[model samples]
Target: MRIVITGGLGFIGLALCRRLLEAGHAVRLVDSLSPQIHGALPDVLAPEGAEVLRADVRRLGDHPEALADCDAVYHLAAETGTAQSMYRIEEYTDVNATGTAALLQALARAPRRPRKVVLASSRSVYGEGAYAAEGTGTIVQPGTRSKAQLEAGQWEPRGPRGEMLRPVPTPETLPFAPSSVYAATKAAQELLLLSAAEALGIEPVVFRFQNVYGEGQSLMNPYTGIISIFFNRARQGLEIPLYEDGLESRDFVHVADIVDALVAALQADVPPGLPMNLGSGEPTSVRMLANELLAASGFKASVRVSGQYRVGDIRHCYADLGRARDVLGYKPRVSLAQGLARFCAWAAQQPAYQDRLDAAAEELRRKGLGT
Candidate 1:
C-alpha cells in the first residue's frame, strides 16, 4: 500500500511512518515544519526511497497532484495544544478546522482520490462533561472544587440536584462539549470529514484518541504529554507538580497502539462515516502515573500538590473501546507501567530530553510555579 501521512515528522506521525515503512509499504510524508512542534525525522523515514515534502495541509489544494496516487491518507497534522488554544483560538481554528477543510476539498478535486482517510480526533472534545461516579454511586461533574483535596482527588457535581447522572464510559455517541479551541477544532474536523464522506463519496474514518505518550515526544514542550513532563522532572529530582490533587484521570494510550489501530482501520473494508475511540479503556490518575514513573526510573522525588485545576479540565475521561475492538479489531498491547519504563529508558539516553526539560523548568520557574 502507498500511504501519505500529513505531519509525518511529528511525534505520532514519525512513529506511524516507521511502522508503515517496516511493514514494506511505500510511504510519502508531508509536513510544514512549523516551528512549534518540528523535530528531526527518524532514521527509518530518512531513506532515499521515501517521499518527503515540505507542504502545509492548509494549502493542500494547491498540490492536488501530490495526493493523486496514494492509497490512503493518515491526517495527523494540527495545532495540538489545549492550554495555548485558550489564548490563540484563531490560530487553532485556522490550522485544525480550516486546514482540514482545505485538505478535504483537495481530495474532492483530486483525479485519483485515496480510498480511505483516517482522521486523528481527540478525547479532549468531551471536555468537562466527562466524569466518574463517586463512592455514593452518584455521578460527579468534573469542574467542582473542594476544600479537602487529597493527593488523588475526586469530582463533585455543580448543576441542579435530584437529576440522575449516569456513569458510563464515554463512547463516540457522547455529545461534544469542547472547552478549548483545539478540541473545538477537532470536533469540527470530525464533523467536516463525516459530512464530506457522505456528500462527496470520500471514505473517512475518525479515531477519537485518548492521552497518547511514547518515544520522540517533546519533553520541553509545555503543551506536550504530561508523562513526558513528569519523567523529565523526576530524573532531575525536581518537585513533580500535580494539578487538582493528582486524582484527575486520563486514559493514556501508547503511540504504538495508536498506530496499530490506525493501520487496522485503514485496512478494513468498512464504509465511510465510522468513528471509534482509540484508547486502553483503563483510567490512571496523575498521582498513580507519577508513582509508576518514579518506580520505573528509580527516582526518589517529592510531589507538590498545587491544588489548582485548569478551567476546562476533565476529571475522568476514558474510552469504552468496545466499538474500536469490534470495528477496527484494535486492542492496546502496552500497559501503562511497561510504556513508562520503555519511555524512561529511551529518554535517559537522550541529551535533547534533558535540555528540553531544563528549559521548560526554567520557564516555569520564571512564572513562579512548577519548580
Candidate 2:
C-alpha cells in the first residue's frame, strides 16, 4: 500500500513510517517540522522511491498535491498540550480542529480519494465526563462536582469523588466533556472527520490515544513528554518534580505500541465512523513512574512534590482497549519496565546528559528535595 503520514517526522509518526517501510510499503511523509518538536529525518524516509513534503497541516492549502498518489492517510499532526491549551485555546483550535478540517477538504476534492483516513484523537475528550456517574459506573449529571474535591488553595477546581475519583478505563461510548481547549478541539476534529466521511464517501477511523513516550523524544522541550523530562533530569542528578502528591495516574503507552495500533487500524477491515482507544489498559502513578525511572537509570535523585495541580487535570484516566483488540487486533506489546530501560540506556549515552550532574544537584538542593 502507498501511504501518506502527516507529521511523519514526529515521535510517533517517525516510528510508524519506519514500521511501514520494514513491512515493504511505499511511504510519503508530509510534515512542517515545526521548531517545537523537530528532529532529524532519518535517511530511510529519504530512500530513492520515498517522498517527503514540507508543509504544515494547518496550511494545507500550500501543498494540495502532497496527498496525491497515496492510498491512505494517518493524520497525527497537532498542537498537543492539556495545560497549555487552557491559555492557548485559539492556537489549539486552529491547529487541531481547523487543520483537520482543511485536510478533509483537500481529500474531499481529490480525484481519487484515499481508501482510509486514520486519525490520532485523544482520551482528553472524555475529560471531566469520565468522572461523572455515567462514566464512573455511578449516576451523575454533566455538571455535578465530585464530593471529594481538591483541598483549598489547590490550583484547579476538584471534581466529584474528590481526588479518589477513578476513571473506568473509558470505552468509545463515553460522553465528551472536554475540560481543556485542546481536548475540545480534538473532540470537534473527530466529529468533523466522521461527518466529512459520511458526506464525502470517505472511510475514517479515529483512535483516542493515551499518554505516549519513547526514544527520539525531545528532552529540551518542557511540554513534550514527562518521561523524557524525568530521564533528562535524572541523568543530571536533578530532582524530579511531582504535581499533586505524585499519586495522579495516567496510562502511558509506548510509542512503538502506538505505531502498531495505527498500522493495525489501517490494515483492519474496520468500517468508517468507528472510534477506538489505543492504550495498554494499565495506569501508573507519577511517583511510581519516578521510581521506575530511577531504577532504570541507576541514578540517585530527590523527588520534589509541588502540591500544585493544573486546571482540568484529571486524577486518573485509562482505556478499555477491548474494542481495539477485537476489531483491529491491537495489543500493546512493550512493558513499561522494558521501555524505560531502552530509553534510559539511550539517554545515558547522550553528550548533553554528561557533566550536568552538578547543575542538576544544585537545582535539587535549591528546591530542598532528593530521591
Candidate 3:
C-alpha cells in the first residue's frame, strides 16, 4: 500500500516510517522540519528507502501530488505545547486547526482519495479527565479548574456539591472539554476530519494518545514533552522543577508502543470514525517520574516543587484503553521503568543540548499563564 504521513520527520513520524517501510509499504513523509523539533539546518535524517517531501501541513492543498495515489494518510503534525499554547493562540490554531482543514482540502483534490485518514488526537481534550465523587462513586467528567482554584492550590477537581473527587481512567465516552488552545485545536482537528471523512466516504480513525515518551524525542524543545525536558535538565546537572506539589499524574506510553498501535490501526478492522485511546493504561505521578528519570540518568540534580502552577494544566488524566484493546488488540509492552532506562541510555550518547526550560517558563510567566 502507498502511504503518506504528515510530519513524517518528527520523533513519532520517523518511527512510524521505519515500521511501514519494513512492511514493504510505499511510504512518503511530508514535514516542514520545524527548527524547534529538528535543530537549525537539520541534516534531514529521514529513514532510508522512503520518499521525503518538505512541506507545511497547512499548505498541503497546494501539493496535491503527495496525497495522490495514497492508500492511507496519517495526520501527525501539530503545535503541541500545553502551557505555551495559552499565549501562542494564533500560531497554535493556524498550525493545528487550519492544518487539518488543508489536509482535507488536499484529499478532496486528490486524483484518488485514500481509504483511511488517521488523526493523532490528545487526552488534553478531556480536561481534568474522568473523576468520581468520593462517597457517591458516580463517574463524572469535570470541567476545567478555575483560575481561583489553581491560585489557592486546590489541585484536584471537585464535584458540583463541593465533594472530593478522585481521578479515574478516562474513556472515549467523555465529551470534549479542552483546557488550552492546543487542546482546542486538537479537538477541532478530530471533528473536522471525522465529519469530512464521512462525507468523502473515507474511514476516519482518531487515537487520543497519552503522554508519549521514549528515545528520539526532542530534548531541546522545552515547551512540550516533560520527559525530554526533565531528562535534559538532569543530564546537564540542572535542577528539575515540578509544578503544583508534583502529584499530578500522566499515562506515559512509549513511542514504540505508539508506533505499534498506528500499525495495528492500519491493518485491524477498527470501526471508522470512533475515537480510541492509545496509552499504557497506568497513571504515574510527576514526582515518581522525576525520581525514576533522574536515577536512570545517573545525574545528581535537585528536584524542587516550588508551589508553581501553570494555567491549562490538568490535575490528572490517563487513558482507559478498553476501546483500543477491543478494537485493535492494542496493549503497551514497555513499562515505565524499562522505557525510562532505554530513553536515558540513548540520550546519554547524544550531545548535551542547551536547557531552554527557564526561557520557556519565563515566556509563560510574562504572558500570565504561569505563576
Candidate 4:
C-alpha cells in the first residue's frame, strides 16, 4: 500500500510514518515544516525509507501527485495551539479547516483517489466533556466556562441550575461544543471529511485523540503539549506553573498507543460511520502530571498553582474508549508512569531548547485570552 500523510514530519506523523514503513508499505510525507512546530531552521531528516513532499496543506490541490495512486491518506496537518488559536483565529482556521477543504478538492480532482481517508481529530471538540450533576448523577455536557466564573476562581463546571458537576468519561455520542478556535477547526475538519468521504467513494475514519505525549514531541513549542513544556522547565530548574488550582485533568495517551490505533485502523475493518475516541480512558490532574514528570526526570522544580486560566480551556475531559475497544480491539498499554519515564529518557539526551513558557503566557495575556 502507498500511503500519503500530511504533516508527515510532525511528532505523531513521523511516528506513524515509521510504523507504516516497517509494515512494508510505501510511505510519503507531505509537510511544510512550519516554524511553530518544527522551529526555525529545523534540523529534521526525512525518515530513511519514505518519500518527502515539501508543501503546505492549504495548497495541496496544486500538488495532486502526492495523492495520486495512494492507497490511504492520513490527514494530520493543522495549527494546534489552543491558547494561541484564541488570537490567531485566521491562521488556525485557514490551516486546519481550509486545509481539509484543499485536500478534498485535490482528491476530487485526482484521477485515482485513495480508498481510505483517516483524520486525526482532537478530544477538544467535547468542551468540558461529560459530567455527573451533583446529587442526581445525570451525565451532562456543560457549556464553556465564563470569564466571570473563571475570574471568581470557580473552576469546576456547573449544571444549569448551578449544581456542581463531576467530570466523567466522555462518549462519542456527546454533541460538539468546541470552546476554542483550535477545537472548532478540528470539528470542522471532522465534518468536512465525514460528509465528503462517502460521496467520493472513500472510507472515512476519525480518531479523536487525547493529550498525546511521547519521545519525539516538540519541546520548544510552549503553547501546546504540557508534558514537553513542563519537562523543559524542570530541566532548567524553573518552577512549573499549574493553572486552575492544578486539579483540572486530561487523558494523556502515549504516541505509541496512538500509533497502534492508527495502524489498526488501516488493516482492521472499522465501521465507517462514527468518530471514535482514542485515549487511555483515564484522567490525570495537571498537578499530578507535574509531580510525576519531576520525579521521573529526577528534577526538583517547584510547582506553583498560579490560578491562571486560558479562555477556551476546559475544566476536565477524558475519553470513553468503548467504541475503539469493540471496533478496533484498541487498548492503551503504556501507563502514565511508564510513558513519562520513556519521554524523560529520550528528552534528556536531546540538545536543550529555551524555555518559552513565560513568553507564550504573555502572548495569551496580551491577546486577552489568558489571565
Candidate 5:
C-alpha cells in the first residue's frame, strides 16, 4: 500500500514508517517538528527509499497534492500527555485538533480517496475507566475525585456509604470522561476523523493507545510515560518519585505490540469506525513499575511516594483488550519484565537525565494544573 503518515518523524510515526517500508510499501511522512516533542531530529524518519516532509499537517489543506494516490492515511501527530496539556491548552488544540481538521478537509476536497484511514486515539479519553461500586457492583464511569477529596489525600472515588469503587478494564463502550485538555483533544480527534471518513465512504479505524513505550522514545520528556521518566531518573541516581501513595496503575504496551495492533487494523476485516483499546491488558502500579525500573537499571535510589498528585490524573485505568483481540486478532507478546529489560538496555545508550521533570512540574504548578 502507498501510505502517508502525519507526525511521521515522531517516535511512533518513525516506527510505523520503518515497518511499512519493510513490508514493501511506499511511504511518505508529514511532520511539523515541534521541539517540545523531539529534543533532537534524527538522521531520517523513513528508511532508505521512503519520502519525508518537514511540513505541518495543519496546512495539509493547502498541500493536498502530497496525499495523492495513497492507499491509506495514518494520523498519529498530536501533543501528548494529560498534565502538560492542561496548561498548554492552545498548543494541544492547535496541533491535535486543528491539525486533524486540516487532514480531513484535504481528503474531502481531493479527487481520490484512500481505502482506509487510521487515527492514533488514546486511553486517556476514558478518564478513570470503568469502575464498579463495591456494594452494588454495577459498572460505571466514575468521575474524577473532587478537589476536597484530593486535598484530604483520598485518591479513589467513593460510593454511597463511603464504599470504594474498584477500577476495571476500560472497554470502548465506556463513555468519555476526558479529564484533561489533551484527552479531550484526542477524543475530539477520533470523532472528527471517524465521522469525516465515514461521510466520504472510507473505512476509519481508531486505536486508543495505552502508555506506549520502548526504544527511540524521548527520555527527556517528563510530562508523559512514567517508565521512561523513572528510567531516566535512575540513570542519574535521582530519587524515583511516585504520586498519590504510589498505587496508581496504568496499562503499559510496548511499541512493537502497538505496531502489531495498527498493522492488524489495516489488513484485518475490522468493522469500520469503531474505537479499539490497544494495550497489554495488564495493570502495573506506579510503585511496582518504579521498583522494577530501579532493579533493572542497576541504580541505587529510594522510591518516594509523594503526597502530591496532578490534577486530572486518574487513579487506575487499563485496557480490556477483548475488542482488540476479537476485532484485530491482537495479543501483546512482550511481558513487563521483558519490556523493562529492553528499555533498560536502551537507556544506557541515551544521555543522562537533565532533571527536566522538576521544571515540568513547576510549569504545571505555575498554572495550577497540579494539586
Candidate 6:
C-alpha cells in the first residue's frame, strides 16, 4: 500500500513511517516541521524512497494534494497544548480545526483521493468525562469548568448534594464538552473529517488517542506532554511541579502502543464509524507520573505538589478502551514503567536541554491564561 501521512516526521509519525516502510509500503510525509516540535530538521526523516512534502497544513497550494498517489492518510498534524491553548487560541484553531478543512479542500480538488482517511483525535474532547457520584451511584457528565470554579481551586466536579465523584473511563458515546481551544479543535477535526469524507465518497476512521509518551517526543516542548516535561526536569536535576493537588489523572498510553493501533487500523476489517479510543485504559496521577519519571531517570529531585491549577485543565480523564479492543483487536504491550525506562535510557545519552516549563507558565500568566 502506498501511504501518505501528515505530520509524518514527528515522533509518532516517524515511527509510523518506519513501520510502513518495513511493511513494503511506499510512503510520503507532509509536515511543516515547526521549530517547537522539531528544533531543526534532521538530515534523515525516513528510509530511502520515502518522500517528504514541506508544507503547513493550513497553507494552500501545497497541502491536501500531498495525499496524492496514496492508498490512505494518517492525519496527525496539530498544535497540541491544554494550558497554552487557552492563550494561543487562534494558532490552535488554525492548525487543528482549519488544517483538517484544508486537507478536505485539497481532496475535493484532487483527481484522485485516498481510499481511507485515519484521523488522530485526542481524548481531551470528553471534558470532565463520565463520573460516578459517590453517594447516589449515578453517572454525570458535566460541561466546561467555570473560571469561578478554577479560581476557587475547586478542581473536581461535584454532585448536586456535594457528593464526591469518581473518575470513570469515558467512552465514545459521551457528548463532547471540550474545555480548551485545543480540545475543541480536536473535536472539530473529527467532525470535519468524517462529515467531509462522507460527502466526498471517502472512508474515514477516527482514533481518539490518550496521552501518548515515549522516546523521540520533544523533551524541550514544555507546553505539551507532561512526561517529556518531567524527563527534561529530571535531566536538569530540577523539581517536577504538579498542579491540582497532584491527584489529577490521565491515561498515559505508550507511543508504541499508539502506533500499534494505527497499524491495526490499516488492516482491520472494521466499518468507518464513530470515534474509537486508543489508550492503555489505566489512569495514572500526575504526581505518580512525575515520581515514576524521576525514579526511572535516577534523579533525586522531589516533585512539588503546587495547588495552582491551569485554566482549561481537567481533574481526571482516562480511556475506556473497549471499542478499540473489540473493533481493532488492539492491546497495549508496553507498560508505563517499561516505556519510561526505555525513554530514560535513551535520554541519558542525548544532550539535556534547558527546561522551559517555568518560562511557559510565565508566558501563560503574562497572557492571563493560567493562574
RMSD of each: 4.0, 5.2, 0.9, 0.8, 1.5, 1.6
TM-score of 5: 0.96
Clashes of 1: 0
TM-score of each: 0.86, 0.86, 0.99, 0.99, 0.96, 0.96
Off by over 4 Å in 3: none
Residue-by-residue lDDT tens digits, candidate 3, 237-328: 89999999999999999999999999988877877668999999999999999999988888899999978899999989999989998998
Q: Please identify model 2 stretches exceeding 4 Å from their true place.
A: 39-49, 129-164, 351-371
Cα lDDT of model 4 by residue, 1-371, tens digit: 99999999999999999999999999999999999888999888878999999999999878877897999999999889999999889999999999999999999999999989999999999887999998999988989999999999999888989898998899999999999999999999999998898889999999999999999999899899999999999999999999989999999999999999999999777677689999999999999999999999999889999999999999999999999999899999999999999999999999889999999999888888888
lDDT of 4 at 301: 88
Candidate 3 local Cα displacement, residue 91, angstroms: 1.0
Candidate 3 or 6, higher lDDT? Answer: 3
TM-score, candidate number 4: 0.99
Residues 162-263 of candidate 2 have per-residue lDDT tens digits of 433334567778788787788899999899998888777768899999989887666655554788878878777778888778877889888899988888
Error of 6 at 366 (Å): 1.8
What C-alpha lDDT values do all the predictions have?
0.76, 0.76, 0.91, 0.93, 0.85, 0.85
Question: What is the TM-score (0 to 1) of candidate 2?
Answer: 0.86
The clash count of every prediction, one per candidate, is: 0, 12, 0, 0, 0, 0
lDDT of 6 by residue, 22-62 (tens): 88888988888888877765543565778988888877446
Kindly report which residue stretches of model 4 are placed more than 4 angstroms away from their true locations once superposed. none
Number of the predicted model whose lDDT against the real structure is largest: 4
| Model 1 / residue 328 / CA error / Å | 1.9
Instruction: Give the lowest summed-lDDT range of ten residues in model 3.
Output: 265-274
